[model samples]
Target: MPIKESRMTQSQNVQLLAVKAQQALMAALRSGQLRDGQFLSMSQLVTMLGLPLSAVREAVKHASSLGLLVTMPKRGIQVMEARPETIRDCLDFRMVLDQEGARRRIANDDLTGLGALRDRHQAFREAALRGETGNTPDGPIEVDLSLHDFLAAGLGNAQLAAAYAANRMRTAIIQNARPFLQDRIISAMEEHLAIMDALERHDADAATGAIRLHYTQTLRWWGVT
Candidate 1:
């Protein structure tokens, strides 16, 4: 699941620090060790993670970049809430970003890398079809985000890919907030399959329609459409 962030090819030391720090922070948050409104400084994080200041600095920097930890001058680093507004804005951005991605993939006839991702995508779809079982922490929702990340990465644009990866947890937060929404889960599975089918057929028109359907379905899941 290292493909969860930082392109598989050029994984950096800081990226590894980021992953560990983020995981630790998440574990702390879920366990109520990190409260909703609490703030911590770099030194505290160093102590919390039992690491040196340099390591904690990079780790904290990475978490801040992903909006997980917000650094305020007087308050230090605050655990940022994944608010509904955050999900809405992230989803809004994704609809634009990922739809353009789909367009580019179709325009360039770049279905090559995507084929390699099909097996994982199918696993993601099945995870969606079944909410809790056969899975990781967030189950199907986590797989769905990974699938989206894969599709975004296949666009061959590093900056866009990074942005998509950063916004992914927002999507997961939204879905995890309602993990048992069976109808939305099934709709997501269907839209994912439709998009995959269109990509396999190399049908630009169908792909476009399917991508639109996917985003529109996303809005419906958000209760916005």
Candidate 2:
């Protein structure tokens, strides 16, 4: 290969490794192997991620830039804290995106998939009430995340969508430290239904209001004021 091509290939390989390391970090987080505000050295991170030093270093840089980790001088990396400030910031960012997304979606009159989502939320809530599923059923969470993704896509902006996804992932990791508010699934489902209802009614103001209501409730649920 030419020198430039070789360098490009090496860079690509490093990028791939960095992505893999990031994935491993998320896996560790979801599997309870990692916790919020946990501190560990680069060597330990490499062991945890099972990635090479270079890859881990790149991953750390990327994750840190994404607000997922904090690196200390002469110290190891710290997982994102689950403090009130962190939760507030993450949710606030999401609230902005969601409000704008909802407005755009309402303006475009694009609410075709909302019915199914509302139905799913209802079903999940009903199941939770009946004690058929556990407190935090995976179905509702999937539907909830998908609903947000739907709203974000309505913006029709790839960059905004990407930012939303990144922020959402960070919030998810933070929530892992707290888990879904115990027994709050029903209210969350109801809130989602309200938002969908407003959308179906073509009430942009109501939709935005519902979104804000949900955000306030969520901040409360997270004990973030």
lDDT of 1 by residue, 24-46 (tens): 76556544455544678777877
| lDDT at position 140, candidate 1 | 52
lDDT of 2 by residue, 103-156 (tens): 999888888788887778888878767866555534555656777777788888
Give candidate 1's error at residue 191 in angstroms.
1.1
Mark the regions of model 2 whose C-alpha exceeds 4 Å error after superposition: 1-11, 30-32, 135-140
The regions of model 1 sitting more than 4 angstroms off are: 1-48, 73-76, 113-137, 169-180
Instruction: Give each model a TM-score.
Output: 0.66, 0.88
C-alpha lDDT of candidate 1 relative to the true structure: 0.65
| Cα RMSD, model 1 | 8.3
CA lDDT of 44 in candidate 1? 82
TM-score of 1: 0.66
What's the lDDT for all of these models?
A: 0.65, 0.81
Model 1, position 98: C-alpha lDDT score: 64
Q: How many backbone clashes does candidate 1 have?
A: 0
